[model samples]
Target: MATSTNGAPSMFSKSNYTWMLIGAVVIALGMFLMSGGKSADPNVFNRDAVYSTTRITVAPIIIFIGLAIEIYAIFKRSSPEKK
Candidate 1:
């Protein structure tokens, strides 16, 4: 094994990983909100259930917000350590 003198830093810091986790959770929440609300009878077509505001409107918006959070996390830089 060769001894190395140069110290290398990781691409992402702990805060970045935490932000990623938060974003992932938010996305999952959005997906969960969008999931089906099964009617008691499959034969009966429930337009209201199918196109509810939460699933159609709110969920997509939430997902977009999560995506934005993820983007922010990816671009955010940690402050350099003071000497």
Candidate 2:
């Protein structure tokens, strides 16, 4: 059981950090999917682009899944051996 310089023990295990990183990436991907609904011509409105299924439904679902992952990571217990 290695300790930090402060010697208070680490708060998170390797797996927790890995899960957190994965969740962050998923959230970022969701945000990316929800982006870019701009029209090439400023005078014209692109209804389909703004209201696409990917942006409206899939993106939100992905974002929620990412959030759930993050919550799980935070509450996840580390193995006794790892500690």
Candidate 3:
């Protein structure tokens, strides 16, 4: 009997999907941080610390968006041409 080698294509694979999601989340976080400007709180711990932490939290969102774009491009490339 012949063994089946069928499997999901790279774009649709679990690993790829997970990575894409992670990337999107990263990018989103980055955007959030950049847009946050600086913490406006007058008495919450430290202003700079809060601002910096917010900025750091945003890095992932940027990364995630890039990954998602890449995945979209890959899928587009693999799609069959319409007759």
CA RMSD for every model?
Answer: 4.9, 1.7, 8.6
lDDT computed for candidate 3: 0.55
List the candidate numbers ranked by lDDT, top first: 2, 1, 3
Off by over 4 Å in 3: 1-10, 38-83
State every prediction's TM-score relative to the real structure: 0.84, 0.91, 0.37
Worst 10 residues of 3 by lDDT: 1-10
Candidate 3 C-alpha error for residue 2, in Å: 18
Better of 2 and 3 by TM-score: 2
Put down candidate 1 lDDT per residue, 1-83, tens digits, no spaces: 11224656666666777898899999999999999978999899899998999999999999999999899888888766556
Give the per-residue lDDT digits (tens) of candidate 2, residues 1-83: 33557987787888889999999999999999999999999999999999999999999999999999999999998776542
Best-fitting candidate, scored by lDDT: 2
lDDT of 2 at 45: 95
Screening candidate 1 with a backbone cut-off below 3 angstroms (N, C-alpha, C), the clashing residue pairs are: none
Pairs in steric clash, model 2: none
